[model samples]
Target: MPTSRFEVLGAGAFPMLVHGALILLLTGSIIGSLRKIPADAYGRFAADVVAWGKAKRLVFVVFAGLGLYVAVMPVIGYTSSTFLFLITLLVTLAPKTRTALVVALVLALVFSFGLNWLFAEVFNVFLPRGN
Candidate 1:
């Protein structure tokens, strides 16, 4: 028995309709852009990508930090994991002045501990608490 106005494989009609519309819209957008962007723009973009690939310092540093954060999140819990992540980012990216460091530290603490408390008590959405 058919459940929706448009159904062939038992999917809901509304979802199917939305998906079909999105496909058409995205296809039209891609086709339009394909004709609009110049060939030299693509060549310049590719050269920039290649240059970034060759200079892998910033990209690799971020990837390594993410890997470490994921690996230790279970051991340290959500609060510590988030705080450490923010601190690491600040240390690497933020200015080295004393005032900037102090402000970043304060913000990191508030984000980590404040968010944990808000989730657990206010929203009753408990986050992971590692041992």
Candidate 2:
């Protein structure tokens, strides 16, 4: 609901401003930490960066999947989208084992349907529906 460039506040403005401030604080903290590292210990920073690089692909995939989930929720409805997202995320992150897979599937179903039921029946706050 922002109108003018000079406008300081509006609906959603507070959360947006807080999010930006948090990002800035995190960036500042990372910079400060890196600065405190001695020049001779630069290898430590490089090693950390390398470790992050190795995991960057998985991170990107998870974020991209989340974006797709948000975009499709209105079309597919909340229950289906939530179930799919949870299943995919759980399988992707969990250890590769039969027990782990079974547990992930069970958890995904419970969370997706249980939360939907709770919201609709108890809280009386129905999420968006495709039908």
Candidate 3:
């Protein structure tokens, strides 16, 4: 069953729904533009998508990691969940280099700490600490 935006977002869903509708409108316009493109262009575009997909197995890994991270995050604590999420996403999305891994680690640490601090200090929201 599809969740209602109201159920998920509380009162904020009204604005979010407006944004979502605008995005759909924009997407429709893009599709219309694409349809006006020459048939040869469309064929080339399709080929490009196929070639890109074949070259980047990383796409699969990143999407799978995102799905898993969403499912697992609420069950675990934020720190552990975000760490796993960042590492997996980075490994899948970027080149596997020592510098890349280090950058990802730093980014994950900053994101986790800043987000946690913002919620706790500014918003007075307390996230679960599974430990």
Highest lDDT: which candidate?
A: 2
**Best first by lDDT, ranked:** 2, 1, 3
Residue 1 C-alpha lDDT in model 2: 66
Candidate 3 TM-score over all chains jointly: 0.52
- What are the per-residue Cα lDDT tens digits for candidate 1 across 43-89? 69978888888798767778888899888888999899989998988
Candidate 2 residues 10-73, lDDT tens each? 6677888899999999999999998998887776878988888787978887988899989988
Ranking by TM-score: 1, 2, 3
Which stretches in model 2 have alpha-carbon errors above 4 Å? Answer: 1-53
TM-score of each: 0.60, 0.60, 0.52
**Which model scores highest in TM-score?**
1
Q: Write candidate 3's Cα lDDT for 23-128 as tens digits.
A: 9999999999988888787659878988898888776777878888777777887768877788667766768899998898888887777687889899999876
Where does model 3 exceed 4 Å of error?
A: 1-56
Q: Which scores greater on lDDT, model 1 or model 3?
A: 1
Which regions in candidate 1 have their CA more than 4 angstroms from the true location? 1-11, 50-72, 113-126
